[model samples]
Target chain A: MSSPPRDAPGAGVLRAAFAVARKELGESFRDRQTLLYTFVLPLCMYPAMFWIMVQGVLVVQGQKQARDVTVGVVATAETAEAARGQLALDEEGRGRIEVVALDPETPRDADAIAELIEGEEADALLFLPDGRSEDDPAALFFDSTSSQSETARGRVVSALEGWTEELRAEAAEARELDPEVLEPILIQTRKINPSKDDGALVLSLLLPILLVVMCVLGAFFPAVDLTAGEKERQTAETTLLLPIPRLGLHLGKIFAVCATSMIAATLNLLALGLSAGHLLGQLAGLGDGAPKVELPLGALISIAPLAALFAFFVSAVLTGVASLAASFKEGQALLGPVQMLFMLPAMATNLPGMELTATTAWIPVVNVSLAFRGLLVGSASAGPLLLCAFSLTVAALFAIWFSVRLLSSEEVSLSSETISMTRILRILRPR
Target chain B: MTDPTNTSAIRAEGLAKTFHDPQRGVVEAVKGVDLDCRKGEIFGLLGPNGAGKTTTLRMLSTILAPTAGRALIDGVDVAEDPLEVRRRLGFLSGSTGLYPRLTGRETLRYFGRLHGLEGERLEAAIARAFDAFDLHAFGDGRCEALSTGQKQRVSIARAVLHDPPVLILDEPTTGLDIMASSDMIQFIESRREAGTCVLFSTHILSEAERLCDRIGIVYDGRMLAAGSLDELRAMTGKEWLEEIFRELVQRADAGEGAA
Candidate 1:
């Protein structure tokens, strides 16, 4: 690394690097399809898709909340009408329950009730015993797989308890028995720490998943262009002869790939935010009164770094892997499973009650989701945030080093299509 | 640095490059080749494909380090300091690529800047290259849009933009039409007359015969013969270089058969 004389005739390595970099950027931007893939499509697709899904989910939720539920009534004594009246009283107490009468002689089978729950014909089923005594046993059937069914069961039980209390109070007043004898233990609950916002909770989780998809998608095109595209065009051979250092060329291209991915992630984030806000505003307008969900600027700020770092790491690693794959087609084939690997973690982040511990923070795509959740809810610890960032940076550097090493080797740079194991063995042979 | 007025532009001695395949043992690309090229001279390295001509050129340009021996460009050790050697030489080859996305003008300007040319000087160089190469007709055309010969001309322009004392061309006219080839041959002779030391490799005997002051016949990574065209003719006792080459290769093949 000694200093060389100025005014020398040959070009400097920095100049060669810039020449190559400028050319790559210009070519990439000039292609109409590339521009769309890099910027326009990401901006359009993310929000449009997310908005549709969210709105669909909210509609289903609204319907569930409003749906009326059915309960069963069984005659136990000679006063079948009186028993029906008691069931009516139960329904009235629950306020939203609709009671369906059943024959007492039918034995009120639990299997029939379970079938009703499974078929979705009933949100829940009730089995009443053939007795008027307050001590008579009763049963409720619910589908554990259905949250709505479970909730309906809970509502029915609470209404029955309310009816029993009213009846006992009336009997005590009439017979002059002590009202305190019927009292039992009561439980009450109040949330001490309210979550920041429902939207924040949902969006944060959603954003991480979006980031993982964006990172993987963002790496795709640049990796193709840098490796296979160059090879197909016969540009790689010329590139090898450049006076610039090998590492410089690799880094310059890697930087472009990282930048490409970051642009995509940013566009995706913006599109999602705008579309989500529009959907929320519409829902609130519908009288459901869902609160306006603004992307909190602080949360947005926190997400920016996480998204950028994740994208950089993904692009770097993918570019390295792409370089080794021999061709664009092979690279795509190789990355198909890799894409699945990345997407699964993102999908796992959306599973209800999934918690993020330190271990989760180190696993590539999953960690980004966990960090997003923490940042959005205003509970993100700085330690974990920094740790995830450091891990991503290290991964990116590793990828860059691997790619550089590949680019530096004569065997890799000079590789042709239809490579044979013998030829590879020949290259690997010691001189 | 050597005395600029007295020293040859390039001096290479006993250059060798060996490729060792894990399964095949060793394949030598170049073997013990020595060369001296003075200013205002065109030295040709004539050989078949895979005969180590490109490898020798790569070593001399500092793109490949010699497995054995050393080289000096104007007295700076190329193996020790390639960056220094790079600044002293201009290189072009059939495989040298043009950035297809960039216009010819932009390509030249970009490369000029890389060589630390800027402001008026850079502009002047770009303008001179365009005019001298007749690149003005399509200077604004993107490289991908240019015809193959046009791209070749642009590649040559990029190489000489900095006007180094030494020029290296590896099959620079392999795919060009006759007109383009003649233009290129003239350009190389002019560059030499302007005091640039030139070394070109080609499989075409006619090109080397017409343009080179001294020609080195390389085969199987070894220099089979080296001398001026007349000296080579006298030594081989053949009037035509093609006849001499055929005879020599036939002899080599016969020797191998006997072995």
Candidate 2:
């Protein structure tokens, strides 16, 4: 038979990369483990993790909401009767001053008082010492270590002050004592930091950071497998030999990895969404509510493509470098460091006060993280987005070029010689 | 005696290849060899280990480029357009690989596509190869699961799936069982009858003597003799081709150049 028509060697070449992409997608779908790990597990894992975190926050908030505690009033009959009539008036809907009156003559015991704090039964103890008079103030004994106890201490002090004023007024009416002399000075304490009252300070930071983590974690396995795994299994040699273009193989694998990551990330986001109600209920004290966070539809759509691009760029660079490495073992060894480098920028977004910009947008790992954070906090700037997209495209192109060079390099293709310590020393030693 | 005007299926002119090691500098693996293999004939290239026979075959198959000179596969220069040369030829090395994960059928189909076969043609070709190689029993079996002989048969099946006009098989029967070897020998004879120019390389002299229409004695990268077995025997003044081969290679190693 004669040679093939020369007019369209280029057409076949163009389709080659797509063909490889298709094959990679098929292989990924074929593996049951890949599906479970990339898609199914992330879906279940993120919500479960979020729920646990929220549950912890909620338990603390619930204690904070209790506001006041019941304290034992151990005092004489005369003091007790006077304390009752003079007690601070409890208002409805105030969620305060829930006093469970204890026996006035009960002996003071540390263990019993400790049990009240530990069991969360009471907040404080009003200890009326023996032979206490109307002029003498009753000492409030409460655990400062307990947050509830501290709150209850404030309530007891205010209630006693009210009672002291009423006694002063009654004494003034009956025996001409001065109410002003009894209470001369009043100190007003106010909160200094207004931002603290806005609620859920960590929400803005944690959400963006979590989103970035989810994206990276989701894509990690598939990206490495698509490139390095092929080399390990020796399927790469057979793949390269195919009449399909090398670019097609690179693009195809990138798409597959990207798709896998996107699916995982999307499911993770959904899990977070479903658990949002519970998280809000738990953190209600921290903010007005769970900050009413939702991934904007536009942001979600943008994320899908962005994630795909990120996966492609990552896979291309890693695979390209791995292909050039000495052997399958060398490829895998090198991939870990490459992954770390990619993760560094994203991890940086988790730091307090770190912001994304156009200049830093070109920095690979950081850019993806920053972009993800911006999307999460509803402040994703267009400049940074465009910059990251450009940087990713450039990186992708570079990786493709590198891969092509690797493919062409006879030494890389034929020899699996790795550089060990011995080899390195051979280079270092004098001839 | 063959017609020169019909043109050689694989023609090598003054072919040379030198391998360079960073530590050892340059080693000349092949130097100044000329060969002409005719159509409808089996040309056996015989030499010991490190005799450069494999290198010669690799150059002809366009797997490796020669350092100097040229190899043509049916008139297409291997150096200028290797894919063209590859399209016309099928190559199988003794230790060439089959993907361990791929089934025998998958391997054949993949290679068939690589050689540019598609649609009905690709399927038909693969089916024919499966039938011809008697690989139906293990067609769906992964390459790693198959026995050594079965793997070799699959390799051959993949190599020849495109049914190229030229077949360059380098030590194709090296690790085969006696039965498999016999089957391969018979396959080559039949392919020759159907007009596929067969260049079969081996270290086994008796196999070469039995199979080749023309036998070339290669020593240290040079073809010492190229002719029918009888012609080679006549040139060395020996009764048997094996004796002639021994005498020529021995003489060349002893610093007596070819006559």
Candidate 3:
């Protein structure tokens, strides 16, 4: 066969890099451990964990609501009558609360109230002083430590608030005034962007941080395998002897790692976003008015480039750091702290008022987080987003440069010495 | 300095390397080594452990840069143009490992692409390699599942996938069984007949004696002597290559003490 056509000088390196990436990715897909971390776990873990949590909460709440409680009334005949009328309208309904009519001459004291609860005569005691009027404050005494007492107190409070509102409206009617006069200042809320989905707002708050973390996690194992794993398996020297520049090999590993990380992040978001509506609806006990949790396709498309850039940055940094270690276990130990550097900046999205700004767009992981959040919420400006993309591109390039330089050094790449900070510093020092 | 016009496929002069150890300060791994091998020549570097044979070969392969002097591969300066030098050379060591997840054929394809071979040309080269090495039976199986001899054959196939003119093997038969070792020796001899220059380091004296056209004995990071077997035997007044090696080492040690 005749020789293959030659590529232009620059394209040759790129082609070699792509070849390396293809091999790494193909190998990773075959490894059970890498597949578990990159694809299988993300696809299953989020949905399973959310389901267990939501079911647990619903079970506990159902059990709490199923229990019954009794309350004793100690007051004058007039007040007792009024109290019984209001207590019958308990928000939990009459069957949940059994009203025990105590003697009208019963003492209104702490000892009596405590005995009512502690002796099981009632779960709580409602005490209204003699000659108490509608304006006079009444006391419901219950044990805060007892679940039954707390449940009873909750029901009684709801019933009494309803009774008080009725009394206030009656007083207003007697004075020949509108009941609206009772509440002078009523505040109303409206969304500034009415078209923005409420579910998208919730997802924006959550998905950005999750995406950042998943990206880091997705890059974690592959980076270790491609770099330190090569040394441990004794393939580093053979790979280095290939007729391509070290930069091509470094970029190839980074591309493979970036692809895995982006896939993981995307899969995790899909699982969570799809299940969120059902999980939240169960939590809120809203059957029909549950907000539909959907990832807006436009927002997702807009944020994808930033996410990919961020994944590249993360993959490059991790692969570079992992190359300093001589084995996989040591690579993991060294990278534990480095992973935190990306995590802390990603949590910038959790800050109450944090958003993409000119200054924030220049920050590395922080910019990615804020940009994702803003894009999801339909609040992102193109200027800051462009700046964020530029910043991430620079960071990714620098990471590639650093990794190429590190992998090129014979002391770091070829030596079997144990990794240490001093040694890494020495290797990084200008020759 | 290297002579661009020389037909030597492998050449080195006064190659040296030093490393820094936190406890030992500056450690000279390879003090100074000189070598020359022509096309179709089989040169063996015979040394004991820590004798700097591996380090010297590493420098010559362009895997590690020499702290002093220079080397050339097929007339290309190793340090000045390592990519071109690598393209012209094939390097293998006992420590060189294969990707366990890849099949034998995939591993060949990967290296072929790195050498700028693609499409039908790459496939044809891979097929020829498989046929030549008798690797068809297990070529589609993962390398991790292959036996020691089989992995060695695949590794050799990978090293020569691009048919480099110069070959470097460092203790290539170190972990092989007797049968595997014999197969490796036969492969090295075959390369000689193909007009490929072969440079290898080994501590096994008999293997070197059987295969090398010229042998260099290195001791404590220095080349004590280099010559054909008969020339060494005559120089040391010894019959066996082992006795000649011992005589040269003793002479070097006695020379060091007198200094």
Candidate 4:
């Protein structure tokens, strides 16, 4: 009674907006369904999903490497004895490959060794002829696809090559000839791929795309639940009738949707990063020279801005469309296509040729995805980032504007346009 | 006439609303309706479903603007300054819901803040509401976990949390049990005694007959007749309000038939 009932003016609307936002936030966090989909589920499920996949790959690789492979030597008794001695010299190779000398009673030829390999008793074959001629065969045979067979073949060939070089040196010395004359040139290949940052190509393309997809997924339920959910709960009318301007109310709901989306996105980033980092550490232990790369800090940091922008654009668009929907089910019907529309660009950004560029900087969802990729790979420049940021910000603004328009319309906000029987029948039998 | 804005707690003059669809062209929902509710009086808008009762209530509450005319709540025009009108009014409907996750206290705090009450005053207001509504026992429970009667109580409490001068309720007790309905009726009666203007709509004839100081019978977006129970009985030459309602509807139908 001491003061006027209505607010003084402009500041009141803002205060009311914050009040609405606070309620929206408080209510959403308390909702069990919202909490599950937006926080708990993403946190627990993402790490588990990553764990299963990495474990599967590691198990397969480990089994293949640890499998024992038997190798058969096809040679005369003396030659077999010499070959067995040569293989025995390398103690570390013995654990992986079991070298067996064929009986002196059996023929030591390619066909005999082939039979042994074909019979599955031996994974590969090694043969050395009795004659000391270049024409006489000394061969290593194994299946190309089998890691065990390939390793066995490699061990036998290196041993034979070593014996041959030793014999050549002895013969050259006895004849007082220069061994350099026997070798005209030395050929070696320096491998560019045998060095530098591991998992760069795969993680660069993959982590960003996964993150973008997760961000979208994280925003989905909250955006749908807040706008359409409130209508279904019949709370929209009461909220709409409040003294606060409709834009203030709409913004409050939008912020709630965005907050849930960001939380889900951040949870996913952390879960994926930790699980993936652990997986990489485990994988590094398997090979001495293997490149050990972690899902980077910069990648997660880049996704932050991209996630916020993407979540903002997506949730705003959802709010606009959801405002048109009369119920939660109807919102799903409308938002499903919008979600697919967003998904295509997110997926496309992961393709080989979908790199960030001047032209791509203007495409709404694709630009963010590509820009996110560029940020992770260190290939994006400030100009493209600005361009991407500019376009998405505009799109977000447009969506907010459209949502405000929907909120302002009396017919749109007040009516619950349920699908009537007559309307349903008309759809069933259109004229 | 005296300025309706200056005197009435709630006022509407030739208030109307029309809906438009691409295929249907134009459909009038609330057509050129006029009414008034003064302080310390309860006005009942009696009508069946789809009879524009809700549409009229919506317009008065500032949820929907009148397409043809204007309304004022506590001297503020709804169409011109809906925010001002909403500030002075408390609106409740059968379909108005409580936030399922929030407790009874939180719901009151939420609406009170929206009405610009905060800090110590808001807290004190909530404490008063708790005692007034006897919401103390169940104030801590989440709304979703509460029973139907409790939910209704919380809903009504949310409407009056801001303590607006005018209360607009659309079928507020439509789904309530006998105990809950009696409780709501008692609450409305007390509000009238406290000098608050109460305007509500209902299809229950007995409720209109028992509670309203004056009743308006609405049909097909028009007020067929409006008066006290005795006045309606005298005008329609019927003893019962139900018979009066039947007679008024039949006469309107006959008029349409002749046309």
For each candidate in the order shown, give its overall lDDT on alpha carbons: 0.73, 0.68, 0.84, 0.75
What are the C-alpha RMSDs, in order, of all predicted structures? 5.5, 8.2, 3.6, 5.8
True-vs-predicted CA distance for residue A56, candidate 1, Å: 4.4
Better of 3 and 4 by lDDT: 3
Please give each candidate's TM-score. 0.80, 0.71, 0.91, 0.82
lDDT of 4 by residue, B89-164 (tens): 8888775478888899988887787777878988998998888888988988998888878888888888887777
lDDT of 3 by residue, B1-259 (tens): 3365687988888889998876788989888788889888999999899999989998998888999988888888888988778877889887548899999999998888777777898999999999999999999999999999999999999998888889999999999989888889999999999889999999999989999999999998998888899988877899999998998989988884110
Better of 1 and 3 by lDDT: 3
Best by TM-score: 3
What does DockQ give for each predicted structure?
0.26, 0.20, 0.50, 0.48
Docking class of 1: acceptable
Task: Give lDDT tens digits, candidate 3, residues A109-168.
Answer: 778678768989999988777644676446788899998899889888888788879888
Cα lDDT of model 1 by residue, B1-259, tens digit: 5565665778888999987554567889998888888888899998789989988998888767789988888667887867667766788887557877779998888767656678898999999998889998898998889988789889889888878888889898888888888888999999877888899999999999999999888888877778898887786778888976766666656663110
Find the candidate with the highest DockQ and give its number.
Answer: 3
Positional deviation of residue A71's Cα in model 1 after best superposition, in angstroms: 8.7
Kindly list the per-residue Cα lDDT of model 1 for residues A1-431, writing each as its tens digit.
Answer: 11233653333445454556565667777666567777877776656666787688777666665666665555454434443454444333233556666556545566876776676666766656654547756666677777767667777777667667777898788888777666665567854443337667657766777777877777677776777667766677556545556566776677677777777767776677667666756654444445456666687787788787787678777776666556768767766787788789888987877655677777877788788878877777888888888777776677666666655566555555534446545544555
State candidate 4's TM-score: 0.82
Residue B86's lDDT within candidate 2 is 62
Tens-digit per-residue lDDT, A1-431, candidate 2 = 44433332323654655555555665665555567766666677666777787778776656564555566666766665555554435644333665555676555678877886687666777767545457655667789887778877876787777766666797776766676665688678865534322222334454444555555555555554555555555454445444344455556665666666666667765666556645654656444423444434455566555666676666556555565455545666766776677666666767866667877788766776667657655567888798888887887677656655554444444445543444334433444
